[model samples]
Target: MYKCFLEIGFEAELSTHEDPELLELAHEMCNEDVATRHIACAELRDMIYERGECNPYRMDDVFLLRFLRARDFIVPKAHRLLVRWCNFRIQYPYLYEGVDLWALVKIKDAYEGTLLDRPDIGRLSIFRFGTWDTSEFPVEDLVKAGVLMFDIGIRQPKLQVLGGTLIVDLEGITLRHVATLTPTIAYQIVSLLGVTTPARLKSCHIINYSWILNTFFYLFKRFIPREFYDKIFFHGYDLKSLQKHIDLECLPPRYGGTCNSHAPFGLWLQKIKKYRTAEFDKEMKALGYLVKE
Candidate 1:
């Protein structure tokens, strides 16, 4: 059995030997000076409100800090990102509108994986993408499913603060599966995850990939931003290489780890369903009457 460590709120045991540049950047952005950070956060919040981009919600320090850190403390850029996020929701009402939990579960299970479970030791959420029944749902529905997952992640303080990882196991994926990833769909996926959302993508590991998959990914990479491009790691079935970056204890048994027995996908999905559904409900209710003024 895998040992489970309970973490509370946004706090986690992060690495002490962080990169100096990143350490410095964190200080410059939100850690070094408390009073200055507050001032900057408040200014950005006021700017967001004044522009009438989104409905009035509590722009707490933690919330503002996410945007600030995402844009490297550039208030205008962060504000723009925040506006784009809100606008995406407004434009894609069907995606964010009345969500059906069972539908989400269907999409998730159809892929033979789950994304709602616990984070790794690095305090990063892990998504295992196994065999997917592509015919079970349209690509748009799949994209919406992704949006829902990301929405939950961005809302969670721990995920927002620390970011997450994605492990795509292509063991069972075939050319037929690759066909579903059209250029348009690829662009939409990249835009939503890389550009719109506030969640930081720590790393994306594609394991058990084939040459055909690599070719497709090369095309997909063109649509993603350069910054995010660096985070993509191709293991090609090399679990040892992957473990070099991520702890073995954090992964499921299928991925050569000990944790799967402790926290199965079903249990994790249930917890996420319960929590995300309520959060989505609250957001929709809050913005229920909001009109694009």
Candidate 2:
């Protein structure tokens, strides 16, 4: 059926809910897979109960709301997906604990793609999200959520970018790389940050960036719309750095904004502790091909 939908362009939007990510959440209420179905639906329910503020970009809140018009706009699969996982937990309620959530993330060198949709450090800008005090605990689940960076054109996975190049840092050139130590590094850092996890990543988004204003604006003295850019298409880059990049739309961005503003570091463990859930899963099954540096 899904294959058929592909030919017909049957598109289904995902709500901000976390359950859909489980993949099994798509299983129908009547489908019979026993363990698979039970785990999928049950776990889906659990994720919802544990749900806090769903990322507006990832999942939609409206999907949970049944009948926006009282009779129309029913989202059963959504409702089921969002909360079924929780149903699995009624027997034993537990929260992720004792895992160091603040795992140091090393962005791997991108062999072929681009990175997009990563942490929103702008909000976390020391001013807004507040700085972390090791004495306090937070940001564990967020650590678990990892990141969603766009891989514009690169293809190879898992090569850590050693450091920014002379052009990328000084001239402000954008380079792509894979995260060298997602699972392995997570092992070390999570132990330090103190949060539990299968240590799996949340998701990955792919997009592009451009440096526009740096090329123009001073002459026009007038403003250009940022939407006017020519290269980047996917949304969510740092409003600060993205200004440097002009999407094909040619719109001008705020002077200080660009996608580079995306958070570079992990949140403090103190923040992750608040909504921690243990039943989610623990024990990182370490396995891999580490490109020896």
Judged by lDDT, which candidate is best? 1
Candidate 1 residue-wise lDDT, 3-58, digit = tens: 33331121122212234554454564334344477888888988977888775355
* lDDT by residue for model 2 (146-179), tens: 3211110000111110000000111222221111
lDDT of 1: 0.59
- For candidate 2, report its TM-score: 0.22
lDDT of 2: 0.23
Segments in model 1 whose C-alpha atoms lie over 4 Å from true places: 1-36, 49-63, 109-130, 261-267, 273-280, 284-293
**Where does model 2 exceed 4 Å of error?**
1-73, 83-98, 102-255, 258-293
- What C-alpha lDDT, on a 0 to 100 scale, does residue 267 get in candidate 1? 41
lDDT of each: 0.59, 0.23
Prediction RMSDs, each to the true structure: 6.5, 19.6
| Shift of residue 59 alpha carbon in model 2, Å | 19
